[model samples]
Target: MKNYFLLLICMILLSCKKENKKNFDESIAAKLYNKAKVFRNSNVSDSAFIYYNLAKNAYLERKDSLGVGKSLVNMAILQHNKQDYYGSIETSLEANNFLRKIDDSTTRSTLASSFNNMGICSSYLYEFENSILFYNQALKYVNIPSNKYLYYNNLGDVLITLGKYPEAQKNLSIALQTKDSLKYATFINNMARAKYYENPNYNPLPEFYKALKIRQDNNDLQGQNSSYATLSIYFFDKDKIKALDYAKKMLEVAVKNNSKEDQLQALQKIINLDKENYLENFKKFQALNDSIQIARSKAKNQFAVVRYDVEKIQREKAEKEIEGLQKNFGIGILLIILIGGLFLYRKRKKRLEQEKELEVKNTQLKMSKKVHDVVANGIYQVMTKIENQEHFNKDEALDELEFVYEKSRDISYEKTDNQGEEKDFSEKISETVSSFKNDEVNTYLAGNDSGTWKHLSTKNKEEVYQIIRELLVNMKKHSKATIVSFRFERENDLIRIFYTDNGIGISGDVIYKNGLSSTVSRIETINGEIIFDTKIEKGLKITISFPAS
Candidate 1:
């Protein structure tokens, strides 16, 4: 009884210790997260990103997926604000892996925020399609009316940029339902702009002025800058004088708000409009643009370095934990290595045997193909000539049979050298076509001279010879034609062969079977294209073209 009580006490102590560690880790994660929020609110983006990344690691250690997701979302937003758009997108995607796809409000809100940040980053990067997709995803997860309005506004703006005026107006109309005065102002301005884009004569100046007025009343300098920029663009072609005034106003608001990107934009408009001080404004634009690029590059590098440092620390901690187990597991690891080596050796031996078997099968297939081409096709050609001709020449038939016998013998020796056979390829093609001619079918050949076969390689000539033979055989069997013509021509670097027969055309789908399948494979091997045109109602036309080289 005493021993049982002692064991129970030990178990209780161990459980409490684990519980304490969990609480401790969770507290650290919460504190780090709160610190990040404080830094972000104070506009110290770098510090906020670092703390959020750290909080993410802490939450990961505690296996708190929600905390990790929230931290990553904040980090992604910080990256976005710093113009590290690609990095922001990557972080936002990582956050999505941790976030739950559930109806829980917090998870849904975080998921929406992550997607919304990705949309904004993609828009900045000029990936309008991806931006639209992300914004739609944000809308899917977002239940809050204000966020929905914001997403719709963003989607509408992107749609307008894409020249989708109707879609822009549709989304903007949805956004216009918002009671928030600032959001309403944004929606109306966008809606007006969409109308103007759809019809250039449509005046959006009144809505632009109204949005500017609301921004001014609310002390929203950023919003006012946007309004001024739009108005400047609206009057840019119509009235340079009015456009110059709006551009100057935009510059003033941008400078007051200390927004370098906005300042650069306003300077560009002013440089184009205010010609009197083009050089001065151009110089300012160049300097500010350079400074912004440099700052953004540094911020991107800083975020990367911070993330790397956190990961490095985590890796070092894991390595230390692993080090203590290595000595104890040394014998077991050695045994596993020995067993694994034997298994791999056996697997490799089996793989080699399988490869040998496959090679043998492939060789058999090649020999079978040689037999079909040299023996079977040769006899069929002879039979076709005997069937077509009234005065069958015994001497010519004997010579053809001897050639087939020799070719069949060469297949056993795997002799692929066809230089002798392909030397007179043009004559061979003429004879093959002539042999197919009979009382029912009239065969004619054009451009089948030796000069036409001069540029083709021996292998290519052989393949072409076989292809013509296969087509003639197929025509003899299937195409009960009265006339067949083969036209061969060389144009530039290409050799083209056109075969036409006034036969009942191949009906339905032309399944590549018999020797037709091998014909295609042979053509492909020579980088050739053979198109069998079965669309003709009365006859069949086959066009074959390939490179002369």
Candidate 2:
């Protein structure tokens, strides 16, 4: 009886001690988290990160995996908010692993959230294939009918970025069906935004008006601001003064939200609609963008600091730890700064180079369109007329031929710059066939009324155009084709370019002569597959299908 009483006293003392410890850790963690919030609210990212690091350490030392995961998720958000995409990816990946190990349903949304974020970052990096993969992964976790809206919206955005328009439209329509307020705003904004580039019917102006009404009623300042920004672009076509007025309204809300990122983003997009005060506007844009980016970076660093502090507090409680932890942190900070500085510098340089290239490409595209409409097609008409006229005198024909030859040579020389880099495929085909086609050939086009080049990339456009030209030349020289029909259409991810002609078909025993050998070589070089459809009187229909990218 005496021994039992002593043992009970010891147990009571230990229990009381543990209770005190738990209370202490919880108090400190919560306080640190709140302080981090205060710092973030004040636009002091560095201090916020310091506090967040402390909270992360506190949760970690307590062996609270759920808390740790949540803390990490917040940190990941901060990192992404700062544009530290690689670091954000790593943080999310780690958090996702923890979430996967946990079976609780309460925080299961973390997995889908992480995947959606990863997909967005991947799209920013232009890794379209991987972006699609991550978006699809998000769908697995967000399959619950109630939770499907945001995931499908995110997936649709990624698909659109991947140039998978049909798939994107399907996903976006489903996302809208859920009518989730935030997701609805986002999906509607994105869908309407696509009208500016890809779709012709739904102008961004009407969609923005509708979205703005909903957002204003809900008091969603961010959505209202974004819609206004988009509206600014839309109305520049009709009312410039109204567009600028709306754009200013957008910047005001972003400022009120205390979201520097949004403020800068809104300002940048809105400036595109501005016509006057160009220099002043550009200076303001650069300064504001830089300041906001710096603030976000500081906030991200603060989150990192908070996590570190929590870890240190825990280590000190458990078996005595070495005191060199802070010293090592100093060294690590310097190294990371140096490395990050170098990475940012290189990334900036690369972006500048890409912008320059894009500018040149846009110029080339404009020139090519002009040439196709004015010069190339005009020459093709002249050639066709000449072939039909059947002129009697050789001398008169020689003068006309000389004029065409000199003009065509000039165009050819201009196109040969950068090894045909500037030539549009349709223009090239028009030029090449005019040079080779006989008078009486009749051409039928199926599905070519889409004005011919809506969906083609410059490279594919050039290649496919060449393919058509080469086939026409081959038929005229050897196959004796009078009538030809060309077809081009898209299905799934593939594009099929096919042509049929009432011409002599090839025998397997005979070696490909004239332009046939060159056509086969070109197709092979492009890694495109060719199917021959030729039977006795059936003539020839060659179809080629290849991956778009």
Candidate 3:
């Protein structure tokens, strides 16, 4: 009985120690995180990163996911400020993974923040589509007014980059409605930029000045630098003096903040706008930019090494967890392997079946094209000849119809090769034009004797033959004309075909329906160009150009 009582006392003591350690670690992590936030706000990125990482390690040791996620958020922002965009994205995504595992209002807000960081990083990397996607995702979970300001402002900026000015303006306006001074400055500045891009002649200077004034009053150094930078760019082509003034101000602010990147940008603008001092400024800008780039590269490498160390630690932890799972369930592991193999085999079989089906569909599409060009065109020509003839022969009609029917039935049939068979390719083109000749239209052909036809491949010639034949058929059926002309010429490496008709042209803009749309698709397939012109008073004019090869 005494031994049992002693054992219970021992367990109680251990539990108390564990609880005390948890409370102590939590307090230390919270203090570290608060210090990191202060450092981050001051733009002391290196100090912020050190405290954030320290807090992150403490949180990890205590198994506090929320603390870890918050620390990662600060770390990611530090990396982003350092211009380590790829590393920022990685850290933000890791934060998101942790924050998402705990479903709560606070965690959801943290996840939204992670997504916002991801959007900013993506925008910096020029992945506009992914940036927009991440911004929208952030917006979806952003319930806080402060977070809304961020989401809407960022969304507007990205939309501006995408050239969706109206949408950008709308989003920026929404962000402004939140009535936050800092947000107001940012949104107005972005709105000014959007308006400037929407119309070059429109003056966005008033809005720019408003944002600048607000930022200056708030003592926002970063915002002031941004305003100066934008103002310099805004006045660059309009007023050189104002541009140089703003550039100088930007340089002043950047130097005060010790922001080398901003200094480089300001110097570049000054060099561009200050024509009198351009040569001197150019040398200064070149020297400063080179030095900054080297420093930045070194800093980026250091940050990347830190991130790699963090990743390695996480990977080690993951491997340990996986090892535990493997040891705990040997039979389950064997079953999983068998199931995975079966799943892969089935997936492969399904993919092969899909591929086979796609092949068949593609073949059918090709066959349909053949039928439209060969059988359908043949029938249309025969009908036109019959309509124009004084008398129609029944045997000739039957023979033509039977030939088309047979061609339609043969699924394995190949298109008749016209290579070497047509001793004169131009003669074949001339014959195609003559087939459309009627009593009402006087058809003419020019440049048909050019040796340009020899330069085109057999496939190209066949496509040309079909295209010209289709055009002629359309003219015959729809064009009520007195004259039609076909002219083919070669300019260097391009074959140009110009067709003009004296027919009563259709009214207004030409609407390409079935036949013309198909013609366009065929021309596009051969990487050709086609232009059509039709008016009430003028007859239709069509020009086609394609490479000889």
Candidate 4:
């Protein structure tokens, strides 16, 4: 193949013969960027990742923060596509350093996007805390509030998932606050949901009407369908015929959207409300469910192909380079043989390097699953127990739960050695606190000196993370705090976390009697101290201090 790069260099030099200039080699990198964009649209995630890897390398070589940040965004998406939720969080965190270097508004958008996807990953894994954390983080970077409608909606969804009806409604309300009719319609649909779930007396007919009217006007097929389903549910208790009509409309929309979940849910309602119509919809529901399952697998396969293709291109490019250099060097027969040997050596060296890279990637993949599935999973399980008011001689379950989250935190943060500057630790904290925000409560993380935080070992760092996470969880359940601030402070030889909130604070007497309970033990394990600063109407502030050095 002709080297367009060389031709371009020749042209630039020829055109500017009057003055000498240092030419930049951006051809290979530009190709990577172009290919990645193509693969991303094609939905070939793995191939997309390979292309993104190339782009990342090219941009880094050129010291382009924008390019690097974009590549990281693509990498994170690929990780999510591959079901490596924990891996996506880790990669996004690594992407953060490069992102923080960029001054452009686009970088902010990129960060928001990264956080949005991270939230999805965490949510699917049932790590509600991490999911909410990422959602809140995304909210901050959405420069255009109009672009934040979906984010706020999603935030409300997670809040509902946590069984915090009031909190969910609050978030959904904000989602509609812009007064964009289309957005407001969506929120009404969501609010209908919140009321239904959290309050027995909640009636959604009026809200559902508001949603239906807006969705119908806007031609929002999905939203219209959703409103219909809610209406069906709302009328189910009163009028059977009315419920069936609404249910039929919902089913039609579900079919149009090709949404299995919605279809199944709609059909299930129809069957329950009108058992006489079951025989008809049941067949369609089963078929649709099967079809969507196959679609999911097919999508996964397509993503894998893209990954393979990207690798093939890079290998082909390297082989061509080595072969061309060897054949073009016709200075002497002896030189040709020497050059061929050098080429083979280079090829072998590259192969070894690839092996090392693959090993590192696999290790990361393992750690990610462990962190998300094992540790985050355990946290959710314990949280579920607490939320449902389940039996709590819970010492056995609590002990098992704490063990997993702490261990995952320990292993997942091996590189930082528990340093304050650790991005993973910061992210981990965000993930933990994120789940606690709801109608009645909100969690906010503030004042981290990421640029200045430097000391702490990986173990110590994770220990700090676990301690803070446990404390925050406790505050959310017990503090009755409407507003909570997760503040991180570092001084010479001392690291401190001040979890202050406008909630009911516990007295020091309670702490002495119930100190180091559950998660607090993990904090004590790391030689940490906790103090309660509570006051009337001011809420509660628990200051936790630990050794940074």
Q: Estimate each model's TM-score.
A: 0.56, 0.49, 0.53, 0.52
TM-score computed on alpha carbons, candidate 2: 0.49
Question: Compared with the true structure, what per-residue lDDT tens digits does model 2 show for residues 1-549?
Answer: 134523432342223234478877777667767776887789665556555655666666677666666666766766776666667778888878777777665557767777877877776544557878887887777646656777787777766554456777788887888656765777887776644446546556666677788898899988887787777766655787888888788889988887666666556545455645533554565455435433433444444444543443343343122223434566777766655865686588668657755765565565455445444454455546545776543333323433333343433234431223323444444444444422235565565433445555556665666677667756765676767777777676676788788877676555264446767777776678887765556578788887654
Residue-wise lDDT of candidate 1 within 297-383, one digit each (tens)? 456556766675556455545544544455567777775775586568658866865775576556656655666676677767876
lDDT of 4 at 109: 88
Which 10-residue window in model 1 sums to the lowest lDDT?
9-18
Give the candidates in order of lDDT, highest first: 1, 3, 4, 2
Select the stronger candidate by lDDT from 1 and 3.
Answer: 1
Candidate 1, which segments miss by more than 4 Å at Cα? 1-19, 101-103, 316-549
- List ranges where model 2 is wrong by over 4 Å: 1-64, 124-128, 143-147, 194-198, 236-242, 269-273, 319-549
Alpha-carbon lDDT of model 3:
0.72
Separately for all candidates shown, the number of backbone clashes (residues 3 or more apart, or on different chains) is: 0, 19, 0, 16
If ranked by TM-score, best first, what sequence of candidates would result?
1, 3, 4, 2
Q: What is the lDDT of residue 417 in candidate 2?
A: 19
Expressed as tens digits, the lDDT of each residue in 20-118 for candidate 4 is: 221243665677678878978997655557667767766776788877888888888877765556667777887878888866789998888888988
Superposed Cα RMSD, model 1? 25.1
Per-candidate Cα RMSD to the true structure, in Å, reads: 25.1, 19.0, 22.8, 11.9
